[model samples]
Target: MTRTPSVSVVFVCHDGAGRILLARRSTRARDEPGTWDCGAGALEFGETFEQAVAREVIEEYGTGPEKIELLGVRNVLRPGSHWVAIVFAVRLDPAEARIGEPHKFDELGWFDPAELPSPAHSQLPETVALFT
Candidate 1:
């Protein structure tokens, strides 16, 4: 059976500066363990994009988004899978953000967009570029 493309909500949680938050996925993560990625998750059946963004951020970061703006959408197709991701620029106090899920993320940090950490998630660069 052919699987339908998944819908995801992505958030670039920024500190109102040029720095964006990235989390290093732990070994328990599905695809890219040890790779840095912005906060994202599959959108639940009844959740709105904004709601998913808020829920995912809080679930992953331990804090809520103070402000969220729709950036754009990305249609991603890999060899055997696809997804449409609705991206958003989320502003939150960097101090308030922490690793809420230790099993999912090993480390989290804020970095300059121009100097992102190594071993980043494959789609992170392009997904981040959509903000500008």
Candidate 2:
């Protein structure tokens, strides 16, 4: 891969009450299979952060966001790859959330922020702190 970094729109979808949605990564996921994480996708060229987040939410969660709040940005660096993670907290209808991408995620769930699922993506804890 080239040394250039890409931009990713990472977001946590919530019910506006308290619970946040998470997806369990499947074996086909690029990394961290079996770990739970927020929804995310590449920032397609010419699209704004909100657009990317909205599109990703529907494509990943099968629901649209009622509200979107930018939490913060993160420079996510790993061994071989790096990306700029623009994080957001999105409010949506939890009842409509399902695993939109079956090849990438095997399961989906909503949990209290204080009691998120274990074996989370390595960056999850810090990312959650940016909002809650």
- Candidate 2 residues lying further than 4 Å off, grouped into runs, are none
In candidate 2 the C-alpha lDDT for residue 123 amounts to: 86
* Candidate 1 residue 26 C-alpha distance from true site, Å: 0.7
- lDDT by residue (tens digit), candidate 1, 8-123: 99999999987999999999998889999998999999998999999999999999999999999999898888999999999989999999999999999999887889999999
Candidate 1 TM-score, C-alpha based: 0.96
Off by over 4 Å in 1: none
RMSD of each: 1.0, 1.3
lDDT of 2 at 82: 91
Each candidate's TM vs. the true structure? 0.96, 0.95
